[model samples]
Structure formats: structure tokens, C-alpha cells
Target chain A: TYTASALAFALRNLPVPVILVGSQRSSDRPSSDSVLNMKTSLAIFKEAPFGEVVVCMHGTISDDYVLAHRGVKVRKMHSSRRDAFQSINDAPLARVDFPGMRFKMLNPRFIARGRREDFQVVSKFSDRVVLLKFYPGMECGIIDFLVDRGYRAIVFEGTGLGHIRNACVDSVARATEEGVLTIVTTQTIFGRVNMNVYSTGRRLLKAGAIPGHDILSEVAYVKLSWMLGSYPGLDRKDYVELFHRNIAYEYNPIHKDSLFPVWSHEY
Target chain B: TYTASALAFALRNLPVPVILVGSQRSSDRPSSDSVLNMKTSLAIFKEAPFGEVVVCMHGTISDDYVLAHRGVKVRKMHSSRRDAFQSINDAPLARVDFPGMRFKMLNPRFIARGRREDFQVVSKFSDRVVLLKFYPGMECGIIDFLVDRGYRAIVFEGTGLGHIRNACVDSVARATEEGVLTIVTTQTIFGRVNMNVYSTGRRLLKAGAIPGHDILSEVAYVKLSWMLGSYPGLDRKDYVELFHRNIAYEYNPIHKDSLFPVWSHEY
Candidate 1:
């Protein structure tokens, strides 16, 4: 799922479903989910209405059904579970039942099937982008190391509400001063980052760090890499705008309280 | 909640329950949870059997009850929800029902109340500990920076299965060589890291990076900070043993699939 959204952004106008599939167990294992996963992917290719990048995987530990999640919003939540891939801060795009092979749209916010006259592919990607997860007492000079190394962008997986420690604010400012794209996403993984709530977050905002609202840190890194690689001459204002654009539905406008998966309290 | 576990480790022989409470909304807000949270905390102080640090917070969105989570195993999951704090990789230690003030132990594993003649508090902490969250294209020199800065320990929030990008393996080895404690925890946050399952993880293990089994990165950072400060001249083997020890229940040996807060697939 980490690279799937990047592929979608590069393809820009995907005309047919691009289903990325993987199995937790090896093919030699009888319990391997590969066959069912591939069948579901093929079923989606023949039946689904959306024409975009999606991750197809087991919906449950049992072979009951398979889920197709939006590529940009999914993440590997479990280390070894067959149903590891999950949609973060969003719902799975569709579900395909096991024996029946019935296709159903779980979320209606996906791009509809269509063809574009000017469909173009930009496969280029810059490897200079980095993701730094912020914690208390982190060394601020690490930011200086990346900026000094000619990195194009640095994405920070900040703490709750999108905050870096007060000590790292100056390093963020220096990154921005060096013309490196500085972005902040929450390390919480399940909520949007609102930098306006706390003083630490506010200081980071003042230092010109772009808050990546509901986007996962991995997705943010990929998006920024693609942007830098695709538009080498993109101006400062346009670059920030492009980073925040919902081109591939990467940014969910409003995360419904019910969207939180198993957090019982959200109810 | 970040500092609660550290405080518990410092005051290892806690005689009475230390209930940490905080509100999502300000006290001035009509919907603030401060009063109810404080009440639940006080209720736990008077009646709960456990004599350890625990976070007391709203268990649900309404005034149903408040939960007491083991301080070493809880995290602020949501940005602003009243029930933001969650017990990670473990169940809440107990619950304090609102109005009824009924107290119940949800998890049986807890330190029982007792008097200790040798009780001592080590309030000292080392600021030389740093946490680095690993990602693709990360600059390896950041590890060098922390090690050269006289940092005592480096905790890495690595990818799935506690693996860093292959490019970082050399730097990790160098840190271990310099007597810097190198620890790796999973970024997945919900599962124990099994380095034996993948080559990347195995390589990290071979590099002398201690796998922080199911320990949250923040907790690892705090525990290390406390360990380094309290025992300044500790030997190498002793430090690793202390880290792996469940001094304050900081390590949850097994993480059942159901412990995952809201990932629907676990069911």
C-alpha cells in the first residue's frame, strides 16, 4: 500500500482497476491466502466500478471475503496477520464475498470508471525524500543532516495533533529556509493532524511545516517524492498547493467518527 | 501518559495508586471531561487494589465509566477525543464505573499493594536518549550524529517486524560498537516484532540491535532514559537485561489479536 498510491499519482488517470495483491503465507502453505486474494483481485478487475489503484487482501482471518482498500489510505497494521492491510482514517473501497464472488462497494467516495483523452504517465520518482518520526528528546541536528545532504523533502511523523518537541522547531525552520519541503503527519496513524490546537504544533506551523491532515506518513513521503520528481521546476506556492491537493483522493475531507475501526469509544 | 511509565519506573516501589488524569476539552467547556475523569481517578485511588501508576480517562464517549490503563502500556491514540488514551498490546488494568463508582479489575496482571522498607525514588533522567523512526531513504548519518553527541541510547521505530531500510544496517552496527544501546521496535504498534521471520529483520538483529518485543517506542525511550540516569555506570549485559525485564510491566509478552483496538480483521 505504501507504493500503490505513488503508482496511482504517477499514472494520474488510471482507466482500469489496478489491484495490488500479496499473501501473508507462502504458496507452499495450504493456508496461504494467495489463491483467494488473486481470485478476488481478478473478480474486482471484472466487476468493480472504480478505475483507480487499490489493494486487495483478506477481509478476515477466515476465507469469508476479500476487501479492496483505497491505495492511498491503506496501511499494513499487523506484522503477520493475513488481514494485515487496513484502510487508515478511511473505509475499504469495496468488498468481494468468498464463495459467491459478489462485489459490493463499501465506500462510495472512489473515482468512477472513465477514460481520459490526455492520460499521461510520469514514472519518475525522487529518492531524496525522508520520513522522520518525532519523539520527545529527539536530536534536532538530524534535520540539519538531511537538509545538508541535498534532500528534496522531509516528512515528519509528529506526535498527537501534529507536534514536534519545542526543541526541534528551529531545525524545521532551517529545513524550510533551505527550500526543502517540510511536512508534518501524525504518528498516531488513526486521526487527522490539527496543528492549530497546541502551542508546540503552532510553533511548527509558524516554522512553515505543512500539516498533512489525514494522510499517512508513508503516503505523504511518496506524494512529495512524486511531486518533486514530476515537477522539478514547481514554484514554492504551487508546490505546497500540489502537496495538499486531493488528486488521488489521498486526503479524506472529513473523517466520520464511525470510520475509526475497532475503537469502541468512538461510538 | 508518555511520562507516566517513566515516573513509575523511577518510583519502582509505588505503595499507592498514582492515577494520571487529563481532559480532552478545557475545564471551561460545558462538554469537558475533567470533572468526571477526576472523580473516576479519585475513586480508583480510594478503592483500587493495584499500587502502581495508571492513567484514568473516559472509557467511552459518554459518562458510562472511566478506565485505568497500565501506565507503561497506554498511549494517547486520538488527537482530541475524550477516550483518546488507549492501552496498547494489553487490556486496561481496571475500570471505574461512573456514578456507581464500582471498581473492577479487567486484567489480572498488576502489582499488588504492599509496604516496602527499602522504597526509593530515582528522579534523575538522561536527556541523551533519542528515538528515530525509520523509513526508506532515511539518512544513515543521523544515527552517527546521535552516537557522536554522547547519546547513551538510540531507540528505532523500525518498519514491519522491526526492520530498518538495509541502508541503515551499518549505522546500527556502529552504534552498538560505540557502547550505545541500540533498540528496535515496530512502527506497526499493534504486534510483537519477530526478527526471525524476515531477512531484513534478521540482519538488524545480527547487527546487535535489540528487538523491543511489543514495547511502544515512547515507552522504550522513557525506560531507557530512566535506566541510563538511575544507573550511570551499568555494564553492557546488565543494561540489555534491564531493558528486557518487566520492571514496571512495560513489556507485554504476548499481544493477542483482540488487543488491537479497532482493526476489524482481528475478529
Candidate 2:
């Protein structure tokens, strides 16, 4: 969901407009070395020197030229070929040929709008946290182990968006109240957590969770670490509030774009 | 990273125009409850339903009664009751319960929009697939066990976005390309595959594998079951392509909303 988003964000926000490209073909294939994929991507990147996002994928032939895809517009075909990538609901920002003519590339990467110094790693992650994924008949003692081991936070990958066995809530609550900040992320990759929508999630929230907001679990762990690390000297009250703040785009309360591109692990 | 986005998206897209007026305080708190929060949210969701998305967190008894938070705007305030949740690079969408009363409440959450469907459960998991997550210094026999079990698919939760130690790659390739449908996902939850980003990711992708595309492990398990079960008769060509399809928003090629919302879990 996010591999491309992070790459897109990096490119669009970068000082230069580097075109993003990926090949569906296994590089190992006899003829599938992504030779054309790389050539086309390089063409798109060199298209314009200014800031922009572009994804180039195989177009028509096994050698069918290529298409320049928009970062946000791109989707996966999963075919194991350069064509595995496709444009989503939106249209491809533009299209171009392979490295045959690098000079013809229109959009060049350029980060001219912002200060260079501000090019900081906007993605902050809470490294100390671990996801104690709850499974059927999961041992409650796991929570004890996490807490005893000094885990700063535990984002439960609950059954739904957020729900754990009733038996586990108090233990979680105890952990949270003990200053081992506990939160819940969904085992489901999609969908939102409406604790009130169900008896289960509601109970967990009431006990003491700072909802994960829609941050992916991996993102949550890293963000939590960043937050915890930031508030090293604060007390419980402060710690709880600190977690709520959008320290790094952690909890984007309003912007949808902030959530999209759900930038995550590198592919 | 997502709880905020969950709310952010709820406000942005869900046609109900549900203004999320929530309280940090629950109904049981001394003079606490979401009463005022609910009232305010209802009014907003009811009135001026378009043009923007807003979030009213208690702005200030500490000037923190409920600041109308924007989707993308978030800042990490170092010290304040509402300090944690701040506007980044921008101001609040509109403050609620503070010095003003704008966008009155409307029907409590009306309805969510754009629900994606048209997918089936991957029930064949019983026949084969397995998720092999890596830990430091893992043994070689682990792969042997899955292969021995005659598993049809083996998904590795790589260190980052689908990366494993060098030692495991050869075995993984030999086992999967040999017909195991081996795939890779990141241990980190948010990102998707970028086989080209690193040599490791590239190598794995080349070894006859598919990238998990940020699909969470929970979904990965079910989806794999569904895919393998449904397409048991197909060739690797068709089988691998199935992984990249956007069957039910499990992995949206692109999401328009900025923040996913506080409710990222999808139970």
C-alpha cells in the first residue's frame, strides 16, 4: 500500500523530479531484466527537472514501449512483468519512450520551492514499540512479558479495527496505566476502527487506548518510538497527550493526502 | 499514524458529512463526557456539510476545548493539554467550543461512502500457505519444514519492506520458484514492496516471488488463501498477477484522503 507512496512523496517533495519506475517482470527472467523498464523510468525522470511524481511501466509489447505513470495513479497488476504496474482511477500524468532518447524527457526533478535545509526525514518512527498480535487463544501472559521487559508501547493487531478478547482488556489497561502506553491497530489492513460500532472495540478504547488513527502497524511502531523518544522527561499526563499530537504526520486528523501513500516499508 | 487519518478520512469523504466531535474525556469524567463534543459534532455534521473537513477536539479549558483540526495540518506542540495534537505547517480547520460556534451539529455519523467489495475469501489456506516471519539468527531448517509440509505458498515478513537476511534468499528462491508461490511482505506494516530499492528486495523479487503491496499480514493470510484456492489450476503467470489486483481496496493503488482517521482498524 505504501511502498510507492513513500517513494512518490520523496520524489514529488524532492529538490528534483526523479521518475519512479518498477518492473513487473522478474529480473531473473531470460528476457525480463527490466531493461526497458529502467530505460523508460529514466526517461520519465529526466522528462522535467522540476518537482513531480512519475511511474513508468511497460506499455504494449513485451517490448511495447512504456507508459509514464503518476505516483498516485499507479496500481499493481501483479503479473510479474513490466506491465504489472497500471494507472488507477486517475490517468497517467504522461507517457514516454525508453532511454532511446533521454534528452526528450520532459519533467526534470527540481525541489526549488522549499529550503534545502528542511529536507529532514519527515517520517518519525517509534522503534521501541512492538505489535503483540492477538490470536485465538493467545496467552494473556504475553502482555505481562512485554510490560515486564520495558516495552514502551504495544499496538494490538486486533481482530477487527480494534478489539481484543474481553479477558485481555484489563491486562492491557493495566499495562497502559502502568505507563506502558498501549494502543490498538487493526489486524485488518483496510477499514477504520469504530470502537463504538462494536462492543469489543469500545471496551478496549475506554480502558485506555489512544486509537492508532489509521496509521499502519509498522508505521505506528515507528511513530510511537519517535513520540516516546521525544517526551523522555514527561509524566503520564504529558505522555498521553504527547502521543496524541501529530509529531510527524503521525496522526493527521484532517488531511486525506496525509494518510494516503501510506508510506511504508521499502518493497 | 493512522488513528488521526481514520477520523480525517471519515470527515473528508463519508457522504454523511459526519463532523467528528469527540472528547478526550469520557462520559464518566468529573464534569466530563462527550456530551458537548457530541453536541458540537452533531451540529457540524448537520450544517455547512461541504467545502472542507473539520475535527473539533476540546479547545481550551486549557484553550484546548476542541480545536477544529484540519486533515493534513498537524504540529507537535511540546507542552499543552492539547499540545500533542497540533497543526503542522497550517492552522486548525476551525476551533470548536472555544470563542466560536461554527458549522452546527447534524445527524450522528450518517453513512460511509465508497465501500469497495467484489472479492472472495481465500479459504484454501488449509491446503497450503504459511507466513514465515524472520527473527535474528534464524535456522535454515525453518524453510525446510514449510517445503516439507508441501505448502503451496510461503510469505516471508521481511525486515523492512520485504527484505530478508542474505542467508535465507537462496533457499527461499529454490523452494518458491520451484512452485511454492513464495511472496514477500515487510515486517514493518505501513510500506509495500520496492524490489528495486535494495539489492535484497530486488533479489527476492527476481527469485520468482510477489511483493505484498502493503497488505497487512492478517489480510495477506486470508487473501492468499482465497487466491491459491481459486486459481489452483492457473500457471504462475496468472497466479502471481492475482496478487497485484485491487480486489476490495485491500491495497488501494491510491487513496485520496490525507489522514486515515483514528479508527484505522478494519474488523
Candidate 3:
């Protein structure tokens, strides 16, 4: 979803639309929601307002509607629920009513369709990228392993506000010295990755890790791969610029309302 | 919060109640909630119905009540908010009303206070335990690093449904062979850790990683440290038995209503 959205955003000037869809339950299961979800997604694909990349999934457990989530903002929250996919930190682009075939716009800024001649495809992807989730006791040697394997980019799924164990800092610095592009995203899925809040995060910045502002780790991985693959000859500076830029809506500004959900006093 | 809860739970048969409290915002700020939160926690400590380890924090941002959450089932969800601490998969043990100092029971299974002879301290903690969070493209050398460090146990904060990258399985098996106790918890935070649902999880089981069964990764780390410290002579089998046994309310059965919050459709 992240990569597809980045690609769509990078080529937003084009006339073509990109729709990413998936099933929560298998088609064979009696309780499977796969068929309805697929049909609803197809319906949205044929007539969505924008040419951007979007994810269409069951908005609720019932088959009444499908949500068109901006690909960059969507996430799979549950392991096996039919309504697992949710738009994080932002509302879905629109909701597509099932049987009625009606569209309700949620976010007002969606782009409109344009001429077909502007469409172009950029399919390059570098396989030499890695995503590493940091924990309390991870060893520094793991970073060395990536550098040894000729990995060009590493996206860290770091702890609170984008931090790694202090012991791992030297290795990250070594990786930077060796010219590996490093990025940090928070493991807390809902929040932004801010490397300026703590000394550890500051040290990481000194070690040359770019803070992935509010981008999901998965999206960062996809974006890094897409960037490296699409522009094979770019230098480290160029790569960093592309990594931080909001090619798609991947870097949404944090909203106060989105920080925490409102709770009813009755609970 | 996790360590405090584990310690309190380990000594739960005590005659006195154990209360764990933290302020989301520091005391100096003008909008600081520290004073009210502290007063509410004190009210709970003096009159809570049980002798268990319970977390006392703001039940709501309004300062209307303080929730006494079972230590084992509690987690810090937000980085910087007055209502950051929450009870996962279960309702809080009790809610204490402000001003009036009223205690309303939520969960009916709380244990009552007992004799002083039941109180015993288990202060020994093995410093050799480790916690590792797994992510894509992580190298196996991390496992070897722990084994080489003479670590007795590892708690893994794995991906969805308790999974790690397939390439790291052999390292886990090697650690198991070397007598390191391995446990798996999900990074998702809200759900249970079930290694039976996916091939990667099953493989982790085969590699001797015990499913932590909804125990938060932080709590698991604290529990393992406490267990190893309390019973230094126990072998791998004893460790496994102690790992699964709910000494506290840490492994409560999931409540259906707790799966997701009720969202108002007006958004």
C-alpha cells in the first residue's frame, strides 16, 4: 500500500489511477468477505474522483460500504478482521456505498481526473533495501551484517519517538560512514517519528539517521525501495531529499484530534 | 510501569495493597495534572478492594475519576498524555471517583486482602535477561550476541500474531539449544500473542519460542527478569511452566467488547 501510494503520488500529474486492494478473509471460507470487498473496490476504481493511489476495503463488518483510504494513510490494524484496514491520522478519501453505488467525500482535498497523455509509469525498485525493528537488547553486529551484504538503505522501526538501544549507536554511525542511507520510524504505529526529543534520538541524528516524519515504517521501506530503484544513480544527498519530501500524503501533519480517541464517561 | 506491576504481583499475597502510579505530565507545567492524579491514587491505595498490584492513573482526562487497572493488563499507550495508561483486553479493576472518593468495581474477580504472614518479598532479579523486538531483514547475529553474553532469557516483541523474519529461526533454535529461554509477544500491543495462526509463528514455536499469550513485551521482560532472579536454579522446563502460569492478572482472557473502541459515525 505504501509503495503503491508513493508511486502514484510521484506521478500524480498523470491521468491514470492506481487502486490497491486485498482480502481479510479467504474466499473459500463461509464467513469470507472477499467477494463483496473485491466488487466494492472495483466499483470505486471505475469512478473515484482522483487519479491517486487508494486502498478500498470494508469500512465496517457489514457489506453496506467500502472506504477509499488514501494509500499512504491506510494501515492493517488487525490480524484477521474483515474491517482491519483503517486510515491512520487522517480520514479516508471517500466512502463508497455498496448496493446504492453512492460516493460520500470525507476529505475535501482529493485531486480531480485529468488528460490521459500525461500518464507515465516508473517501475524501478532496488532490492537492496532493508527494514530493521529495534528492541531493548539488539546487537550492533546486525547493522554490520547489512553493510556487509551491500544493502544500500535501512529503515528502522524504532522505539518511542524513533529511538534505538544506545549500544547500537556506534554501528549506525559506522553504517552512515559507509554510505548507507538510514531512516527512523516509530514502532508506535499512530505517532510521528521525532528524533529531536531525546538525547538518544539526537545522537542518532549525529550518527546520520534521517527522521522519517510521521511515515509508517512499512511506507518508509516501500518509499526507500521505490526511490532507490527509480533513481538508481542518485547520491546520498539526493536520496535524503526524496526520502523526506511528501511525494504522497505519506507525511500528514499531526492533528490534535487524531492524537487520542475521545472516550465516553459511561465506561 | 511493567516492572512495578510485576513486583507488586509477585508479592500480591501480601496484607497491604500495592499501588503503581505515574504522572503523564511533569509537575512544573501550569496545566500539570500531577497533584490531582496523585491525590486520586492515594484515595485508591487507602481503600481499593484488593491486595493485588494495580495501576492507578487518570480514568479520563476530565479528572473526574482514577482507574485502578490490574498491573498485568495495563500498558502506557501514549507518550505524553494525562490518560496515557490504559488497561488492555480487560476493564479496570475499579474506578475511584474524585471529591466524593467513591469506589466502583468493574471486574468482579479481584482478590481480597489477607494476613500479614502471606506477605513475602522476592527481590532477587537476574540481570542476564534480554528483550528483542523483531523486524524485517534483521540479522541472526543478534541472537548469537545474546547467547554469547550469557543471557538466560529473551522476550521478543514480534510482528503481527507473534512472528519474526523466517531467516532468524535458526538463531532462535541455537539459543534454545544453548539453554536460553525464548518468549514471543506481539509488537501490535493491543492483541494477544498467538503463534499458532501463521507459518512464521509456527516456525518460531518449533524454534522453542514460547508464546507469551498477550503479555506485553515490557511486562514479559520484567517477569522474566523477576523469575530468573527469584529462582536462579530452575531449568528450562521450570522456566516454561512459570512463564505461562498467571502469577498475576497479566494473562487475562480477552473481552469481546475490548477489541475496538466505539467510534461515533459522524466523523
Model 1 segments more than 4 A misplaced: A116-118, A263-267, B263-267
Model 1: per-residue Cα lDDT over A167-237, one tens digit each = 88998898888899899998877788999888888898999899999998999999998999888888878
Per-model lDDT: 0.85, 0.52, 0.75
Report the number of clashing residue pairs per model: 1, 105, 0
TM-score of chain A of 3: 0.90
lDDT of 3 at B173: 96
Pairs that collide, model 1: A262-B262
For DockQ, the strongest prediction is 1
Candidates by DockQ, descending order: 1, 3, 2
Candidate 2 regions off by >4 Å?
Answer: A1-14, A17-30, A40-113, A121-126, A229-267, B1-267
**TM-score of chain A, model 2?**
0.60
Q: Which stretches of candidate 3 lie over 4 Å from their true place?
A: A1-17, A111-117, A120-159, A162-175, A180-182, A193-209, A232-237, A254-259, A262-267, B5-14, B99-101, B126-130, B136-154, B165-171, B198-200, B263-267
**Interface quality of candidate 3 as DockQ:** 0.26
Which lDDT tens digits does candidate 1 get at residues B1-267?
A: 567987788886767888889898899999999999999898899888888899999988789899998898898877767777888888888888889999888887888875776467887888989888787766788788778889979988887788888888898889989999999998888787888888888888888899999899899999899889988899889999999999889887766667865554321
